[model samples]
Target: MTLSLTAQDKNTLRTAAYGAVSLIAAADATGSPHKIATHGSIALASATGPVGHVLAEKSKIAGLDGKTVAELADHVLPALTAAMNLLREQDPAQAETFRSTVGIALDAGVGARKGEPGPALTEMRRKISTALDAA
Candidate 1:
């Protein structure tokens, strides 16, 4: 049987995934808010450019091999999150832009997953939101 998800369900999943992943990403990162802010900003700048495209390409390549969306999400989410975390730690302003970019990417990924953001993108969004809140 095939199951379908509504748009609200997809967005809710994305939000939850992002919140959980951000907590994990931030686990080892602790310091004054300023330091955290600096780090997050840098991380954002570094990730803002190509990470999203890379993940989308990866997803497309994986799909060609008949990989499940779940498989693709599992593989891509951590790399995306880690890259963004690094950017967030280095530059907060850029981090904000990156977060917004992730949101857009997540919107796209949701369609790929049949209205749900893939696990990786969802998780990445969580981390992005957390870093933004921190800044």
Candidate 2:
């Protein structure tokens, strides 16, 4: 099936994908936040398929400049769900691709830390996965 995403839909997907990496970076305030973000973003860039295409577009994604973690989550978590919902409705396969792409990006981002993730980082990862599954 052909998936027809509007500009807003594409923006939502971009926001959700990029916002997740930002969330991980934010959650690692005490650690190497820049490393985490770079690794996660690189993984996101490596994604394939429709999800990858949407992420690759360098258009105006929304709500990524939040000053606080909580403020960022307010826009991102819902965007994660919304992106998933839109994909699932139009193409379940793409939805799975989207979910997996985000999950892989999260893993790559979190793996930038050499040792076990701290409690806050662990919880933020869980929340990201939960939001992806919420759709």
Candidate 3:
């Protein structure tokens, strides 16, 4: 069976994803609220820009456009895996911090909303943490 997302749905997903990236970036930069940092905290701040750009660009690619949530998750998994791997190699502690901070954000942002039909952010965070831990 074919699955699709309306333009509004895609825009919503993009906004949420970008918002998460922005929150991370801001936290890494100022270290006030979340304080999520890497060994090279300055570098981490720089890295997030490209990561955010890539996520925005890739999500709108032909194959990913109109995909269901699960399908979109599958498509993005490799990028997420690669990112977690890179972070772990750079700073294991910071990688763990990344996962935790992301989890916290997702809990507040996505988890708080009732009746959302898709993969739980908690589950997604678990997968990311597991991957980082294994690495």
Candidate 4:
């Protein structure tokens, strides 16, 4: 299916996808944040379909520079909902792909840890999942 997304829409998608990785990475207080980010980003980059193409773009995802995790969430969570809503409007299947892509990225980040994720990591994951499901 041909998907139509504006530049702003693309920005929202990129921000939501990449921002999710950043969120999970930030949640890893003790573990290797960089490693989590790397794995999560790779998962996002590996996404398929139109969602993959949009996320694979190198364009800047602004508003992800918040110093605090809360600040970052303020910017990202809404984008997640927005991106999902936009895609589902055009194509539900593509929306599912986008959701799966983001979920996998989160898993990659969380899985980077040696053992079970810490409380913060788990909570942050819950928040991200809640945001994704909000749409």
Candidate 5:
């Protein structure tokens, strides 16, 4: 919830977030970050808080109730990217902080939703945390 990330990790998350968006946007002819930027913007709006609130709010609005893991990720990722991009243009520093915070939240969300790479990411985080704690 309040993880302290290194600058590099922050950048990594930002890149991943944006990359996920690009992937989804390119996959669909009509989907763009602008179309769903609102959802992600909310998440980025809160840099010092857990991003679960924003993501959950968007999920509810998107009718994620009965959707498959892949379906939810497909929808949420793009929206988040669009929002993050918009937030960056609005406030780069704040958006960067929020991007890293949301990265953790997004990873957890994917795992909870049984997304395609959710388990892998969850496991990787666990391993990384363990290793870091041991250091």
Candidate 6:
């Protein structure tokens, strides 16, 4: 079966991706001095709401509180992967665009924090790209 995504679906996925990255950054910020700073905050906020709203929305979708980074990642990654797969099957161009946009967003998020992304974010990026390749 071909899985198709409407514009709304793409928007949801985009929002979710931003939320996921924000969730990870917030978690990292707790322990590290580096935070998303001004640019990252603006980037994320422009897409979704504040970081807290994104986390809450994603958490509600994942059916988890997402109190910790691990918990959030566990839920967000799988959802994102699935969404990518569906988008790839329905519209390859859109899938590519999503992947690129998410990658750029993630990078901006990390750059704002002035630190490297952890393994989870990297893995999610890889998974999104791989889904497109596999399709």
Top TM-score model: 4
The residue-by-residue lDDT of candidate 5 on 12-114, one tens digit each, is 3444343343222223323332332333333433434333333222221322322443554545444445545544655565455555655544343333322
Worst 10 residues of 3 by lDDT: 32-41
**The candidate that achieves the highest lDDT relative to the unseen native structure:** 4
RMSD of 2: 0.9
Rank candidates, lDDT, best first: 4, 2, 6, 5, 3, 1
Candidate scoring better on TM-score of 2 and 3: 2
By TM-score, the candidates rank as 4, 2, 6, 3, 5, 1
Model 4 off-target regions past 4 Å? none
What is candidate 6's lDDT per residue for 26-112, written digit by digit as tens? 555543323543444355445432222332333233323577666665666665666567666676655555555555666666666
Give each prediction's root-mean-square deviation over alpha carbons. 17.2, 0.9, 13.5, 0.8, 12.8, 6.6
Candidate 1 per-residue lDDT, tens place, 1-135, comes to 122334433333233233333333233233232333233333323343433322222111221121443443344454345444544565544445555655553333333222333454446455545544543
- After best superposition, candidate 1 residue 80: deviation in angstroms? 2.4
Q: Supply the global lDDT for candidate 1.
A: 0.38
* TM-scores for every candidate against the unseen true structure: 0.34, 0.96, 0.41, 0.97, 0.37, 0.57
Residue 61, model 4: Cα distance from true site in angstroms: 1.0
Write the residue-wise lDDT of candidate 2 on 48-128 in tens digits: 777888888888776899999999999999999999999999999999998888888888988897788899998998999
lDDT of each: 0.38, 0.90, 0.39, 0.91, 0.40, 0.52
Candidate 4: the clashing residue pairs are none
Tens-digit lDDT track of model 4 for 7-39: 999999999999999998998868888989999
lDDT of 4 at 92: 94
List runs of model 2 lying over 4 Å from the truth. Answer: none
